[model samples]
Target: MPKRLTLTEAQQQMLDLPAELTNEPIIITKDGQPVMAAMSYEHLTSLLETLEILSDTEFAEKLRESMAQADRGETISWEDAQKQLGQ
Candidate 1:
C-alpha cells in the first residue's frame, strides 16, 4: 500500500520521493483528509495506458465479449483461426 503523508509530513518527506515513489505512490493529505497523490513517471505512464484502453468503449466491449466467450468455453483453434483468416 502507498504511504499516507500529511501536509507537513509530505513537505519533510519530499526529498524521499525518488525512493518512496519507486515502488508505490504517496497519498498526500491536508487537514486530516485525503487530498491528492504523487506517483512516479513510470507509474503514471502505466496508469495512462490503462486509462487509454478502458476509455476506448469499442475495444473494451470487444475484450469483455471475448472474455465472456472464453468463460463459456467458446473458442477457436489455431488452425481454425488461421483458416477463418484465409491464411
Candidate 2:
C-alpha cells in the first residue's frame, strides 16, 4: 500500500527514510487532501527505462510492418499518405 504523510511530516521524515522505502512513494497531503508524491530516483529511472523499452518495441513492430508493406508495393509515398490521412 502507498504511504501517506502530511507535507510537514514528509519534509521532516525525508532524510530518515531508507532508500528502498523512499522509492516506495509517499502521498503528501495538504489539509487532508493529497497534493504530491515523494519518490526515489531509482524508482523513477526504472519507470523511465521500462517506458523506453515498451515504446521501442512498439516502434520496431511498426517499422517492420511498414517495411513489409513496402516490399509488397502496398505502401504509398509520404505526400500521398499524408493526403490520404487528411493531414
Candidate 3:
C-alpha cells in the first residue's frame, strides 16, 4: 500500500514527485479526511486501463469465461489465438 501524508507535506515535496511516486502513491489528506493522491503517470495509466477493462461488460464476461476454461484444464495454443484474431 502507498504511504499517507497531509496535503501540505505533498506540496512541500512537489519537486520530488517523480522519484517519490516511483514505487508507491502518496495519498493526500485534508483536515484528516482522505482527499487526493500524488502518483506517477505509469500508475495512473495502469489504473485507467483497469477502469476501461472493468467497464467493458462483454470483455469482462469473456475474461471470466477464459479463466473458468483454464481452471477446467481447457487450453489453446498461442498460434490458435493468433489465428482467431487474424494476426
Candidate 4:
C-alpha cells in the first residue's frame, strides 16, 4: 500500500524516503482529504504506458489475444520466430 502523509509532513519527509519506498505512490492529504499523489518517474512512465496500451482498442485486443495464445501454449521458440522473420 502507498504511504499516506499530511501535506506538511510530505513536504518535510518526502525526499528522505528510501529509493525503494518511492516506487509506491505517496498520498498527500490536506485536512484529512487526499490532495495529491507522488510516485517515482519510472513508475509514472510505466503507468502512462499501460494506460496508453489499454486505451487503444486494436492494440489492447491484440495484447489479450497474444496472452491467451501464450496461455494455450501456442508459442514458438525464439530461434523459430527469428527464422520466420528472416532475422
Stretches off by above 4 angstroms in model 2 are: 18-23, 57-87
Error of 2 at 23 (Å): 5.8
Number of clashing pairs per prediction, in order: 0, 0, 0, 0
**Pairs that clash in candidate 2:** none
The list of candidate 1 runs beyond 4 A from truth reads 75-87
Every model's TM-score: 0.76, 0.55, 0.75, 0.76
For model 3, what is the alpha-carbon lDDT of residue 29? 95
lDDT of each: 0.92, 0.82, 0.90, 0.86
Per residue, candidate 3 scores C-alpha lDDT tens digits across 1-87 of: 778889888888789778989888888999998899888999999999999998999999999999999999899899999999999
- Cα deviation at 8, candidate 2, in Å, is 0.9
User: Residue by residue across 1-87, what tens digits does model 1's lDDT show?
Assistant: 778989899899788777879888899999978899999999999999999998999999999999999999999999999999999
Give the Å error, residue 33, model 4: 3.8
Q: Compared with the true structure, what per-residue lDDT tens digits does model 2 show for residues 1-87?
A: 889899899888877755536548878899999999777878878889877876897787887898898899997789998999999
State the local distance difference test value for candidate 1. 0.92
Whole-model lDDT, candidate 2? 0.82
Ranking by TM-score: 1, 4, 3, 2
Task: Give the Cα-based TM-score of candidate 1 against the true structure.
Answer: 0.76
Q: Which ranking of candidates, highest lDDT first?
A: 1, 3, 4, 2
CA RMSD for every model?
Answer: 2.4, 12.1, 2.6, 2.3
- Backbone clash pairs for candidate 1 read none
